[model samples]
Target chain A: MNPVKVIINKELKVIFNSLLFYIAFTVFFCTTGFIYWLSQGNIFYTGQASLGYLFTVFNGVLFFLIPALTMKSISTEKRDGTFQLLFSKPIKTWQLLAGKFFAILIQVLLCLALTLPYYITIACLGHVDHAVGFCGYLGLIFTTGCYISIGIFVSSLTSNPLIAFFSTFAITIWFQFLFEMLSSWLGNTFIASVFMYLSVNDHFDTISRGIIDSKDIVYFISIISLFLALARYVICKSRI
Target chain B: MNVIVKDLTKIFDYQKAVDSLSFEAKKGEILGLLGPYGAGKSTTLKMLAGLLRPNQGSIHFDNYTYEKNESKIKKLIGYLPEKNPLYDAISVTDFLFYMAKLYDIPRYKVTSRVLDMISLCGLENEKHKLIKELSKGYRQRLGIAQALIHDPEVVLLDEPTTGLDPNQTFGIREIIKTLGQEKTVILGSHILSEIENTCDQVMIMSKGQIMAQGTTAELRQAPNSDFSLKIVIKGGEIPAIQEALNQLPQIKSLQLQHKQEFEVHCTPGQEIERAIFELCKDNDWYITEMTPVQMRLEDIFRKVTQKQ
Candidate 1:
């Protein structure tokens, strides 16, 4: 078997067995469910069967949820000295990171898959744009990949999971909101355009609106690759 | 597989944890790394395990160098790091299976391998229990089991018996001795006697440098090595006996433990025993007891490490 698959299997088994995963899943399910059905801008209030509002709420909730799920991925391994066990095996550092990245991504995907009933219910009530829903889910998946990579990167920077959690949350906040805010405040300057391009929310907004632009896809892929590369670099440098 | 390490060095912050250290171990040999705390034994073992990259060194297993064949070398090595770090949340069986899979054991073979380690490590009763619930001794055994789960040719163990009871230590030593019969094993410990009893070759290190390296008997026979004898005489007066023992050129010093018992220090490679027997025969002192005390590894360890 591939070592990455072994790591992924172990990681998933560990996560699923821990109480933390269930709590994160519950909080995600509840918060998104309440916002979609019972909150002020709920579907009942808007009288619209579209999942646009629910996708926006998911975008907001996942900002914190992804970090929660990924906080312990690498940092805990370093803290527990299990990195020695993994690194000493016939496994490359990238394989280790890739395994963890996909394990956590699988978790986020599982959580999202559980909410498919919301889509079905909305479709039953009124005519729903299947294309928009599919694109919105794709956007969330890309956003999840981007956030998970960032979380794993920050996780590699420290041996403390709390620090990994907060740093990831703090960094994603910048990409999700602060960069966009700063770009708007700069009034369309070249640096502002760079900031806009850097903002994860900008690309997510474009894709979630039922339009899959190559530029947006490229933005998410580059961000994911950049952070994964950075994470690999951090691990390599620190192991010495 | 024979393992060779050359000029291995690891610096943390600005301090050298392992200086330009080097050694070699052939198949069927157990090379013990003996040192006090902060003497870089663990650092050296970590480098050998390929978990830590050396600042200036190279390691090779048989014909494969780490620089060119890291994975190949890793597949042949089994390392038990200090403190026996394990995944506490998993069962003993799960942890071993996880390790087996990580080492790329065939799917059909992993279960049997895990079972073998569980039995070899004496962890059959605790196989279903989570590792967190295990005692320190069981944990150490589990650590060794995981290191050996893949049946690697080279085993590197860092302080494998650090916190075990006498019985547990004996069990671990038995396992190590069994491993040394067929594989190249490098064992690191600060405990001198453990190394003396278990290793084929001993390397005494201090401050990241090797102070002495040789077989146990070779180290014991080094120049300036001294032996002692405990003698008890029945007939001679204390002063006369002391004088007679002192007159022997081979006897260095004498201490009277009780009225009739005397402790005599003798220069190494001397006929002090025969000389004392002859002296007692001439003086009409009846010899009751005489026991030779061999030079201990502790003395050699202190002698070499304290010099620096």
Candidate 2:
């Protein structure tokens, strides 16, 4: 087997064996379901056939949920000294990072796949815009991928899972909110546009609006790869 | 895999963890790194295992060095770090299989290798169980099994038996001694008995530097071997034995331990047992007690570490 496959197998096995993934799966869909169906600002109250509120609220729920799913992937390894064991093998640091990233992605993907019933139910209820819904799900996946990368990077920086969690939450929220706020505060200058282009929400909003701009696609891909690269950098530099 | 480490240095925050550490280890022999805590044993092993990049110098295993062919060198070496970190959530067999695959063993060989390791590490009973369920000793066995899953030519063990009970230590030592017969095993530990019983060649380190390097016998000879042999000659003339011992040039100092009992301090690299027997036979003395002084490792450790 490839080194990356070996690591991915162990990490995925752990996710399946542990209660964390199950708990995250349960809590995520439950809250998203209750908010979209039972709350005062629910789909029934909005009286809209489109899943605009559903996707928007799901993004809010995932903002916290994805970090919870990924916070322990790298931090616990460092805490248990498995990081040393991993590097001792015939594998590069990037292989380990990639394996972990894919493991978190698989877990998140499974949880999202389970939410398909909600999409099907909403479609049955009324005429939902299928293209917009597809783009919305795509945006969620990309946004979650970027969040998972940040979570893995923060986890690599410290051995404490709790620290990894808070830092992931703080930095990701900052990445989502702080850049947009700065861009607005700076007015419509080219510099402000750059910050706007870098904000995760900006690209997510663009794709979720049924417009697949190449620039927004590049932004999401670049941020996900950037944070993964940052994770690789920290792990390699610490050995020196 | 023959190994040579020259001027290998690792500095952590301006403190030299390993300073100009140099040693040679031949294939199919155990080279024990004997040192106290903070003596840089782990650091040196880390560098050799390619886990930690050295600040300076070269490590040549066959022809592989840290600067070049690092990944290939990594494939050829296996390391079990201190504390023996393992995936507690996974079964022992699965963990070994994962390690075997990471080492890029042929797909067909992984199953046989995992099974071979299971029996080799004496972990047959726990093979299907979660690693968290095993005792510390069994976990250590699993750790060693993973390290050897790839059958690397070089195996570096860092304090492999420091925390185990006597029984577990014995099991681990037996495994390592067996490996020593076929692999270039570099074991690091502060435990003297572990090193003494398991390693043929020893490198004693202190404060990030090797203080003594050679076979234990060669190292033991360094403190001048000023050891006294107490001989109790029953009914033998004390003056006669003293005169005979005094005549021998090997005796550095002599004293009367008791009536008919003599203590002789022989210089290093000298054999005086035959001479004493010759004197006793000549005098027809019935010798009751003759005890040769033994060199203790604690004394050598102190002498080397203390620079005395």
Candidate 3:
């Protein structure tokens, strides 16, 4: 058996068994459902008849949701000595990091899969561009990969899951929102462009426009690899 | 597997946790590592198990050195770290099967192997229960089962019985003894009596260095300058036994202390226990008891470690 698959199976089993997953699943769908349908700023109330906010609003929910999902991925194992059990096995640090990253990514994908009905509902009511919605989902997944990597990296820094979650949140809030805002507010064009390029939201925005640019893809992949690499290094150093 | 660790050292926080420790373990031997808390017993085992990369030295299992060939070495060893760690959310059966998969056991063989481990560790009754619901003993059993699921040749158990009650420790100890009959087992603990009762060979470690390593009897006799033996013979043949003892070249001196009791002193570097019994067999004299008097393991360990 591949070590990554074995780990993913364990993570999925734990996630499915957890009541907290169900709670998060509920809160996520409820908030998204309310925002897109019943709320005053909703597409339904504004008669826009488009699910344009789906990616952006869901990304907002995921900003907090993913850190909670990934906080214990590495930290809890370290705290309870399960990492010792794992490190003793014939697996590398990269396998451990990849296994955990994809485990939380799959959970996020499952939650997104549940919201497919909303997409169907919106499609039935108005003229929706299928290509654009597809790109939005793709961008959402790419951005999630970046966030999961960040979460796992922070989780490896400490044994406390709360610290992992909060540090991840603190770091990602800048990537997810603050950097993009800072980029626009800055008067210097060079500094603004650097922040703009660095921000996850900006790259995600480019991809979310239904355009699959190679540069944007490279940006997300680079961010994911960088954080995952950092996480692997942290785990190796800490275990030694 | 015949295991050799040479100059195995690990430095943590600028202090050497395991300092140039070296030892050899023969195939199918149960070697107990006795040490105080933080004495590097676990660290040495971890280095052998490939959990920790040693700063200096090498661990060689037969022809394969650990640093040169890790995956091959890993397949030959199973390590259960100090605190027995397990996934509490998973059922016992699921966890074992998962471990079988992790060990890369063939898909068809996983069930039977897991069943064997479940029975071997006495976890059959709790096989369906979640690990979180288990008592401390059950958890420890599960930990051992995972360590053995793949049938590795070298099994490392660090403080396996640390927090268990006597009964729980007994169960794990029995399993370890059974494993020792066919596998090289390294049992690490700070408990003097635990090592004495369970291990065939013992290595006393302190301050990241090995103070001494030998069989219990050898270690007991190693430190004693005077070699003494107590013999009890039937038919009250005191003079005959004393004369027979006097004829042996290894016997430095012999005396009949009582009618049925005789004491023989052996020269240095002589193992007289086997020779005395052989002498009784040859003379047609029935020996009721032949005991080698020596220091206890506790005394030997304290004496060897504290001196350094």
Clashes per model (N, Cα, C within 3 A): 0, 0, 0
- Cα deviation at B53, candidate 2, in Å, is 1.3
1 versus 2: better TM-score goes to: 1
Best by TM-score: 1
Candidate 2: where are CA atoms >4 Å away?
A189-191, B233-264, B269-287
Clashing pairs in 3: none
Residue-by-residue lDDT tens digits, candidate 1, B1-308: 99888888888999998888988999999999999999999889888888888889888888998788998889999999897889988889889999999899999999999999999999999999999999999999999999999999999999999989999999999999999999999999999879988999999999999999999899888877778889898786899888878788888888999988998988777888788888888989888899987678998999999998
lDDT of every model, 2 decimals: 0.91, 0.87, 0.88
Q: What are the chain B TM-scores of all models?
A: 0.91, 0.85, 0.79
Q: Candidate 3, residues A137-191: lDDT per residue as tens digits?
A: 9999999999999999999999999999999999999998888899889967999
Candidate 3 lDDT by residue in tens digits, B1-308: 89988888899989999999989888879999999998899988888877788999988899998657887877778888898988899999999988888788899999999999999999979999999999999998999999999999999999998888999988988999999999999999999988998899999999899989899988866745457788888753667777777889899888777778887777657778778778877888788887876767888888878876
In Å, residue B266's CA in model 1 sits off its true spot by 3.2
Interface RMSD of each: 0.9, 1.0, 1.2
Indicate the residue-level lDDT of B197 in model 2. 93
Which 10 residues in a row give candidate 2 chain B its minimum summed lDDT? B219-228
Clashing pairs in 1: none
**Which stretches of candidate 3 lie above 4 Å from their native place?**
B223-293
CA RMSD, predictions in order: 1.8, 3.2, 6.2
